[model samples]
Target: MQARLDQELARKGELIHRWSEGSLHEVDLIEEDYFTMLAALNRKVSSLRESIASLEGTPPPRVAPEELLANWTAGSLHQRRAILKRYLHSITVHPPLPSSQFDRAPLVKTRLAPHWKTAAEVTA
Candidate 1:
């Protein structure tokens, strides 16, 4: 709704340039400007809603784990040598998942927070 209004205002130069030029109710623009915009935006929104409704009833795509690993192994070689260099950039040992026994946050906090300065801090 807000987006449709914004589109209408964008197309109507009267609304855009109204401040200095000062013509809010120009006869030609007021008659056809905002309505045309609302119609087009309504169509777009209707189609997007229809797509969402259709997706709600559809099953998602699936990948087999063995196939994924095989594809990755084969495709990695065909990729540019630059990618090989990039892929070997670093091997990092991230902290284990956060745990009451091991860390300050929940066990599922798998990501490290920024500002961990020392290798010792991470390794600890």
Candidate 2:
């Protein structure tokens, strides 16, 4: 098992569950996948603004994703900053634990329960 990956995912999952009740919160993908979705949404929003500008006489310049999320349209600066900062942090600097730590062999039925064994035996 990738310990770091599992820990990151569990942390993200807990945050998502506590803050959101949407289907997206129940999603089972990596943080990278979530960030990619954010990027896609940001791109689509930029495209929409360009389209709107062509229709309207004048539309203001599009904002960068960080700034846009940092200053959310429907919320206070405190809420916006907190949410955006967490989102941005989640987007970067996450690395999975090494695969060598994963248990690869089929689980064998042993005479004793796992808890019955010594810690050293468990490590072995």
Candidate 3:
């Protein structure tokens, strides 16, 4: 990413140099492209910094799947729902097929949190 950012910055610099030399045409288009690339690189760098900071900081608490499952099974509906909300990004419900009965396994698509994935892998 840093290499890509450097290459893009160089290209932007070249564009400016060409403009200064009066050899480049389509000033408006070039300027727009330059600003767009700059903004995108800025966002990428900021996100990268945030990711680095998060990884460098203390790790999150690790939970065993069995313990978590036990808690989930013991919890009330509201508590279970809260746990799901905490660990899952989204749960999409698809419509049943014409010939099919209500089967939740195929009807629901769940996206889980990244940390939960890591925890599961560690336990595995």
Candidate 4:
């Protein structure tokens, strides 16, 4: 949206420059387009400000283990680390049992605050 607004502003500047240079013969049509573009740019800026205001103080929503796993798999190393650090205070992983596959349950432990509930916890 910001990029589009910037492009429109550049077009408006070009229009004015052309009008000042006496190259544009259709003065009335160009004037109408300039004002319409200006109004649209103002509306875009106002909408962005309102969106920022709405998100400014709000906490992010919690995610389930499945969603977390999906994000973890798709994220970069830094992003994955950030997610781990944000959601867990501490984690412990035990070695797999002999001749058995690795199991997340009964081996891994996480310490999250009571206020930060996962989606599964909330639904349960």
Which structure among the candidates has the greatest TM-score?
3
Task: Give the Cα lDDT of each candidate.
Answer: 0.42, 0.45, 0.51, 0.51
Each candidate's root-mean-square deviation in Å? 21.4, 21.6, 17.2, 16.6
Worst 10 residues of 4 by lDDT: 106-115
Q: How does model 4 fare in lDDT? A: 0.51
lDDT of 2 by residue, 1-124 (tens): 2344345445544544543444555657655555554444444554555565566756535345655543364334554554455444232322433677544353233221222334333222
In the range 11-112, model 1's lDDT, one tens digit per residue, is: 433433552254645644562454444345434544544454466754322224553343344332433332334234443546675454576555344443
User: If both were scored by TM-score, which would come out higher, candidate 1 or candidate 3?
Assistant: 3
Residue pairs that clash (backbone atoms under 3 angstroms), model 2: 1-102
Q: After superposition, how far is residue 72 of candidate 3 from its true place, in Å?
A: 0.6
Clashing pairs for model 3 are: none
lDDT preference between candidates 1 and 3, better one: 3
Query: Could you tell me the TM-score of candidate 2?
Result: 0.33
Question: Which of the predicted structures, 2 or 4, would earn the higher lDDT when compared with the native?
Answer: 4
Worst 10 residues of 1 by lDDT: 115-124
Best of the two (1, 2) by lDDT: 2
Query: Candidates 2 and 3: which is better by TM-score?
Result: 3
